[model samples]
Each structure stands twice: as structure tokens, then as C-alpha cells.
Target: MKKKKAALLIALVMSTCTAIAQQKTPKAVMDQFMDKRFGMFIHFGPVTQRGTEIGWSRNDQVAQADYDSLYHEFNPRLFNADVWVKTAKDAGMKYLVITAKHHDGFCLWPTAYSDYNVANSPFKRDIVGELAEACKKQDVTFCIYFTVLDWHDPDYPIHNPHDTTQSKGLGGNMTAFKTRMKNELREVITKYKPFMLWFDGYWEKPWTTADGKEIYQFIKSVDANVIVNNRLGKVNDKLDGDAVGDFLTPEQTIGKLNMNEPWESCITICNQWAWKPNDPMKSLKQCLQTLVTSASGNGNLLFNVGPAMDGHIEGRQVKRLQEMGAWLKLYGESIYGTQGGPYVPNETYGATRKGNKVYLHIFQRKDGTLSIPALANVKITKAYFMNGGAVIIKTDKDNYKIELPATLPDENCSVIVLELNKDAVNIPVIPVKA
Candidate 1:
């Protein structure tokens, strides 16, 4: 009898512990993402307009000098910084990351180190400067995507043995190369003071972990607040999907499950990473569902819309984002500033909670009810679709379910709000008797 009582007591204690853990708060993912729930990832260059891969040559190849000549004629006068920043604002995005320098080595700003920049173009003006000014006007956090591997620069080579052209002007100390690159970093960070430095091209041969460390340390020392991506290291396993980066960056899809730290999933609405003409845009419903799915999974969503070479966002991308803004502006309470809650069974809807109330996002609504079996000792007091006013929840304790009305308001992704009041507070717990 004593052994049986001990086992039962242990079971009860374990059950209570599990309940407490279910309510535990993870990292400060929301605090980092509330203002950054959405952001624009811009991929644009002269190559983007030419219908070519952003930097890769089609054949074994084009002459470096010939390919580099594209920038001389690279003129994007119609590139409206206001339109680009406004599109992000209208789309409910508060941050923007633009490719200040792609692999091709053409600088958007006039760098003192390189003449291969926007200043040399017929449209001789600093586009990045304009973008910084525009983001400041609209209160959007502006960031730079810098690809350290520069193919067009005379100092750096492509690093492929098969191509002899890649080996030119190659005799230089790695320390000198790092020091020179650090100069560009200082120039950009000092001038624009970017919110982030999206460093890429770790595999592009010039970048080494040692080289990256020099750059990373330099930037952080300048402004400790700037958030650097995990690419600076050999992809951090913690922040990368496999613990890499400062945070997890799931490219082009909603990611696999992670509860340790924050995650951001980025996907393009169109086929190309950079702006393409008349590209088919994702529907308003699709965009809403993507954001909902990401938010419910305890992750942030960064929706990508490539800007045209003219520097303005595609019209379709702009319109769809505006529609998303309108919907989120109306029904965003459940998503923004909430934590994912409870070990909900797979069949029921996913949940996000704030204080006593929990939100149920019904991706696949059942015929009559949406149930939550694990939430016990709590009484649900309210129910309603997000866009419409209040409704009621007809709960059955025996079945452990919350019955919905006959029809759902939004078919694509309907959200139900449930206000729950804990019953244990009303009655003291009595120790179990064996």
C-alpha cells in the first residue's frame, strides 16, 4: 500500500510539473520581432534587369572586363526610394534589407576604395544614400546585405583553378585584404548606420572565419546594438536551422519546429529572387495564411518582394502587401506580442496566448467544433472571428471541446479567440488519498 501511494504521488507531481513547463516563456523572440514581424528583402542589380542569374555567368564564360562594363551603363533613375520604403510600410513591414553590394562587386554607394560603383554610372548619385534617407523619413529600420566575395574587383579573383582569369592580381596578404574590407565596413556603417549587416559569400573563397571575425568584431565594437547574421561564423548551429546564425533563418518556407530561440522564415512572392517584369504575385489570402502559419508556430515571417532594377517595387507585390497590411492592421492583436501556448494535440488548432486568453488558429476547421483537450481547469468565456465582433463558445467538459458555429468566417485561415479563466484559484487543492 505504501509503494502504490508513492507511485501515485509521483505521477501527480510529474503531471503538475508538465503543466508548469507548458506555460514557461522561451527566449525574447517576440520582443525582438514585434517591431520586425515583417521586412522586405530586396535583390536588385543591373544583372537582375537583364534576366540573368544575379551574379553567375551563363557560360564558362564572359570576360571579367566585359561583364564588369554593365555597371558603366547601369542607370536606374526611376528608382524611387520613397515608393520602395512606402511599399514596406503599407505591407505592415517595419524593416528593410537591401543588397548594397552583390557578388558582382558593384557598390550602390560611392566607396572610396572602388570606382566600380553607382558614381561611375550615367545616373551618378548614391542610391543607398537615398534609401537610407527614405527609411528614416518613414521610420523603417534600414539594413545592408553585403556579399564579401567581390568578383568584379581587380584585387580578388574567382578562385577556380579551371579558370586562369580568376588568379589575376592575386599576390596579397590575407591581413591586408581583411584590413581593406574593414575600410568599406567603416564607410557604410559610419555613413548609413545600418540596423544590421547581412553578410553572405562565406563559400565564395575570399571569406575565411578568421577574416569574418575581424569584420564582425570591428562592426560590433562600433555599434553594439547592430544585429549581425550567423553567416559571419561558419553558420551558427544555434541560429541557423542547425544552431547557426544569431537567429534561425528558414529560407523560402515555414521551418521545422524549434523552441530554443527565435526563427525568421523568408520567402519570395514571385519566382525570381530579384525583381522580374510582370511576375505572378502571391494572392492576398496566401500572404495572410503564410504570416498566420509562421506566427502560430512561434516564429517571425519576413516576406520578400524583389524590387525592379529601376529601384521601385513591383506593382503587384506592392498591392498584395497593402491588402495584407489592411488585414493585419485590423486583426493583428492575436498574432503580435503573443507567446505560443500549451501542448495542444495535433488534431486541434494551433494556439498563441497573451495573459489568460489563448488564440486558436483553425487552418482546417472541423464540421461543428474546435476542441482543446489538454486545457483543463479553465473556463472559456468568449469566442469570435477576428474581423467580426464577439460570439460565444459552447464548451463541453465531458468531451473536452469548444463547439464552433455552423460556418467559419474566413475559409483560408479562420482565427478563434478564447478567453479562459482558471478554476483552481476558486478552490484550494486537496492532497490525494491512497
Candidate 2:
């Protein structure tokens, strides 16, 4: 009788633990976001007309007066949200994020809170609303990129000596600026219902961590499911370990291998965020390599594209996107929804895993054979090229040697899928020499 009672107690505890483990927690929203490993970032505004980068150009390249007046002539007659969304869809991107408002203090959407919006510009069209509707129509998730540093808002408190006249007429109260920002965010959330809000320019004065937390909480109060980026109230743009934002936003650069928290690398397709006339763009190989590297690091990639002044995506950019889509079509299994490897990614290659399968991404196809050291504990039941065809893998003690065909499966990167005996993987983290 005593033995039977003990057995019953153990079963009850095991069942309870399993139920608790399966319960949805507060981190579910972030987990869902990490699952979407790739997204598109559209950077478009009046600044594209001058063929200069947005926001920063007001300080160096173009006079604030000319930069601000570009809106007067801003008319993107060729603006087509459907085509833009289609291009994103073709690129196998799960979401589309556009600059609803940039640092130049220009609002692409008609916001009742400010007159410095599309309502007063020559465009006179709701860019945000159109893109939101298009994303919904095409079944792509929609997000908004909003900047806290507004150069035109009356409530904004920041003042640069170079643009004293442009900064004039605005109330210089920090309290008023924060309130206006919150109110504008409320309007955006209620109107667009964005899946995420990618806030930028919070490193400026008057933007505090407390302020970032407040806005983040306010956003959750409006919609608990929405994700926020760490740029909100980032202290000097450094990563805040305890920030209220959902994920860390490392801009313009990728990081070393890290899966501690969900993070994203937001980089441009070309040199500039906004379209520059005849700008040298990244090659198809470079773009694919970026995606693989990001995935290997267990992070998402927000690839940026700057539309022309006429609001049309460049043919060259579109072609590269299409090519990337073709590559993803063949080997997306190794990317989307997969977690970073048990092994830390190195320069030559990286790894991703899903269930009992481990994918080795070979970036450098210099030799016809690839050798991965010190994976003795991992038992590979079968190995094959992700795209197609056979792969010969030999395991000797802790070493894994994969012999590849002379002709590579993909030109940019190749993926080798290995079926493991166990559902979970255990890889030793090799410290970087540098």
C-alpha cells in the first residue's frame, strides 16, 4: 500500500509539472516574434526626393530649410502599396515595417496631433494606412517605425544650434514632448494596429529609461500583444538588459553569437537608409550571407529598402529580393522557425536546429569538403543537402567531415541537414580568440 501511494504521488507531480511547463507565459509574444526570423523595412519620405539619406542629412548635406521644404514638393505619384507588399511577399518576408514618422519630423500618415504630416504635404495621402491595408490584404504582418526625435513638432523640446530657426515655434517643455509622443503613439496603435512598434532616436536628451518604460507600458495597456524595440529610452543607444522593450535592436551591424534574449539586426540593402540616386547596392550573395549569419546568431534581420522619390522600389533592389526569395524557396527549412545551433557560429559556417534535425550552413565553399570539429556527442543518423542530392558525412571520434560535390547546391550558401537521434542538441561554445 505504501509503495502504491508513492507511485501515485510521483505521477501526480509529473502531470502538474508538464501542465505548468506548457502554459502560456508573458514571454509568448516575444517568442512568437523570434519565430518570424526575417522581415522587410521600408524607408521612404520627402528626403528621398533630394537623393540624400533621411534625418541626418538635415545636419550635414542639406540645409534644414531645404530639407524641411522638400515636403512641399513631395508627391509620390507612383506609390503603390500593393506592389511594395508584393515585393516583400516575394522575398519570403513575414512582416513589413515602414517609417510612419522619421526623425526629420515628417509623418507619412495623417496624424491629428501634428500638422507636419502627409495631410499638409503635396502627397496628401495616408502612406501608413495604405501600407497597413495592403499588408492585411496580402496576409503579411504590419509594423511601424516611429522616431521620438521630431525636428518639426511644436511640443518637441530638443534644439540644435544649426537649426535654431527651424527649431523655433515649438514649445520647449520635456513634459509636453513626452505627452505628445504618447498621444501620437496612442493614435498610431489604435489606427494601424501594428504588430510591433520600432521606436528610434530615443538616445537624445529628455528621453529617459523611465520615459521609455512608461511608453512601453502604455502601449501594452492599449494592446498587450504588440512588441516594442529596445531603442525606446536606450541609454546612449546601448543595450538595456532590463528594459521594458521586447527585443534588442542592434542597428546597421550584426553581433556575435548570442541567444540570451531575442534581438534583431536592422541593416540597409545599400549604403544609405533612404534612396540615393545610383547607390551601389549589396550583391545577392552578400544579402543571402547576411540572412544566414543573422539566423546563425539566433537573431532576426530587418533588411531595409529605400524607395525612390516616386515611391517605387528600384529595379535592381527588386531583382535581388526576387533572387533571395528563390534561394529561400529551396532552403528556407534551414532558416525560418529554426533556433540557433547548440554550437556557437564561427566565420566559416553556422548552425541552426529544429527538432531532431541540425542544419549546417556553409558560407565559404572554398573546398569540396567541410570539416566540423568536436561534435562527438551528437549522433547523425542521416545527412543530405537541404536543396537536394546526396551528402557524404564521416564521423571519427569528435570530428565531423562532410564531403560535398564539386558543383555546389547554391551559389551563395549551402545547407547540410543532419537528422539526429535526440530531439535536443548539445554543442560546446567555443570562445572567440579576439
Candidate 3:
């Protein structure tokens, strides 16, 4: 009887230890990712030469034969890793996540596992290596974006109609495919030792929860400190709490406020993820607002920049980023190293908190006064504009109001810094009227 009891206790202890290990990411790595709320996403591939979307334009925009033949003509002599990392740095971005491999199965780095890489192109340079070195030099975290669904791989279970060859179908050598992918990933991790692995295109037919867990474990084995996203096919950005992977990636969309899990909204500066002629760009104000919203929601923003065929970010796009950077220079305090909330964001504005201060981000300008519901217990000590000017604050039992400047603080989203008596402010949830 004592032997059985000892065995049960041992089992319980082992399970508890396993659960703790799985739940906790290396604090240093997770803190680095979470603290850096803004990052740069570079989506450059051979498809950019045609001024079309990567991977998706196989048939509609360009013929499959033409698409496959792009590597022969691929040349980005002007490509400079230093300039790429500098662009991100100038924009106040703390990290960069570049496409190591897109769904087109085109690898940026020369991979022995597959011949479909930049090594075969006219460029013949290791783009990933160059960029990783640049990022390290610039004190920027380097991460890679890898896609699981491959249109070029014959072993990949799913077949897009645009592909020149059809797969043997669902029962295709999935085990071999996974092995090849893991091997390639091992090469990347072992070589570059990336800050994080941002995965996408896992919503395919062949991928399963078990596959995600296995891949996640494999990555952990390689570098226990490296961060991984939730797109490993096990969980998604929507599901929080016990979701597998380090962070949630809500592609092209901003996450809701009060998110319990770490998340990032990957959005494009222009409409397309790849370079195209005359592509409309989001305004400087829109860009800052997006970052503000993401921070207010306790999430990160991986703003994407698609480099041109010549490997240069367009002058117009560069100008927009610099303009946004200028704003961040002045009012970045409302963001970086802050936690979201104390007030749920409405269409009008959002809020972020740091230590004993709560920052109210006013999106829409009000003439005389700006008011929002407040927690009854917490006291608002003083209020002032982040850029400049002091304001009178009034607090009632259930609401707080601030006096606005005659002209709103810079045209974009103006931040009002409020000193709080305590570190925590509970923002009471108010139900929406349908």
C-alpha cells in the first residue's frame, strides 16, 4: 500500500513539473518579445519582381511557368541588409521578422534540404544570413517568418490548382514532408539562432494538433529560449489560456482589449504584402493609431514593409515610416514598456498604463472636455498632455473628465498622461447595447 501511494505521489509531481515547464517560457525571451511592442515585417520574395503578391499569384497574376522561372532572373544587386535593419531602427522598431520561406516554397537562405532557394537565383547571396547579422549589429531582435503550406513542394499534402504538378493527394508522404521541414528549421535555428519563429499557413488539411505539438517540442529542443507563435496548427490567435505556442498572431487585424495571451497584429503598410506599383499606403496618423491601439490592447504590432524588386523600400513608404517615427519620438511613452487598460477602449479613444500612471489616448478631438467612465476606487491625481500643456482633471464617483487643449496635441492620436495613486486600476466592464 505504501509503495502504491509513493508511486501516485511521484506521478503527480512529474505531471505538475511537466505542466509548469510547458506553461513557462524562458522569462528573458518572453520579456524581450512582449516589451518590444512594435516590430518590422519584411515580405520580400522573387514574386516581387513581377509586382504581384507572393505565393498567391501563381495562376491569376502570373502563369505557373513564369512564376517558377522567376529565380533565373532574380537579382537584387542593390539589396543591403544594413539599410533594411536601419530602416526598421529609424522607425523605432525593436525587432524584425523577415520571410525566411513563404508559401511559394522559396527559401531566402541557401538550404541543402531544397534547391528552391535564393542560392539558385542570380543574386546567389544568403539573404537570411546577411539580415540576421545586420539585425545583431543594430541591436535588433531577428526573427523568421516560415510558412508550412508549400505550393512548390511535391511532398506537401495540399495542392493548389496553380501548381504545375498535383500531389498524390492527402495520403502523400506527410511524415517525410514533416521530417524535411523539421530538418530545414533545425538548420535555420542552429545557424541563426533567431529571436522567435513566426509561423503561418498552418491551416492546411494535413496539419493536426499533434503535428503542432511535435513541431513546437522540436523547436524547444533546438533552442528552449526561442519564441514560437500559435499558428503551429494547434491553436489560433482567438483562443487564450493554455493555447500552445508563445504568442498569438492575428494576421492583418488588431486584437481586442484585455487579451490574456501575448499577441501581435501583423498589418501591411500598403494593401498588399508584396511590392506593387501605385499601392496605397496607410497615413502617418493611421500608422500611429494602429500602434496605439495594439499597445492599448496589451499586444504587439508587426508592421510589414514590402521591399521592391531592387530590394529597396520605396521612398514614399520610407517617408511615411520616418514621419511615424517622429511621432513615436515625442509620444512613445504612452506605448513601449506599458500595459494596456484601466479603461476599455471605445471607438473614440484607448488607454495604456505604466506603473502609477494611466495614459489616455484620445483618437478623436473634443472641443472643451474629454470624459470616460472610471473605476470608483482609484483616484486620478493630475492630468497633462504628453507633448505639452497642463490640464484640469475632474473625477466623480463613477466618471472622470479632463480639460482639453484649444487645439488637440499633434493631429494624430493625442496622449493625455494621468498620474494615478495606485498601480492597478480596475476598468469596470460595461455591456454594449445591441
**Clashes per candidate, residues 3 or more apart or on different chains:** 12, 0, 0
Candidate No. with top lDDT: 3
Model 1: lowest-lDDT 10 consecutive positions: 423-432
User: Could you tell me which residue pairs clash in candidate 2?
Assistant: none
Model 3 lDDT per residue over 294-356, tens place: 988888999999999999899999888888788889988888888788666766788888888
* Candidate with best TM-score: 3
TM-score of each: 0.79, 0.89, 0.91
TM-score of 3: 0.91
lDDT of each: 0.68, 0.82, 0.84
> How well is each residue in 1-434 modelled by candidate 1, as lDDT tens digits?
99999999999999975554323122353366443667778887766546554666523344455567777777777788898898888877878888888877778899898887888888778888888999999999898888767665555655332356645565545565566678888898999988777777776455566666556667755664566666665654464232223556777887543455667777888767766677777777667777776766666777777776666676667788888888768767767776554423133355666666677777666667554553556667766677776765554654445566667676656677777675222322122233
Q: Candidate 2 at 227: error in angstroms?
A: 0.3
Judge candidate 2 at residue 133 and give its lDDT: 98
Off by over 4 Å in 2: 1-25, 161-171, 236-242, 425-434
lDDT of 1: 0.68
Model 3, residue 55: distance off in Å is: 0.7
Question: What are the root-mean-square deviations of the candidates from the true structure over C-alphas?
Answer: 12.3, 8.3, 3.4
Ranked by TM-score from best down, the candidates are 3, 2, 1
lDDT of 2 at 401: 76
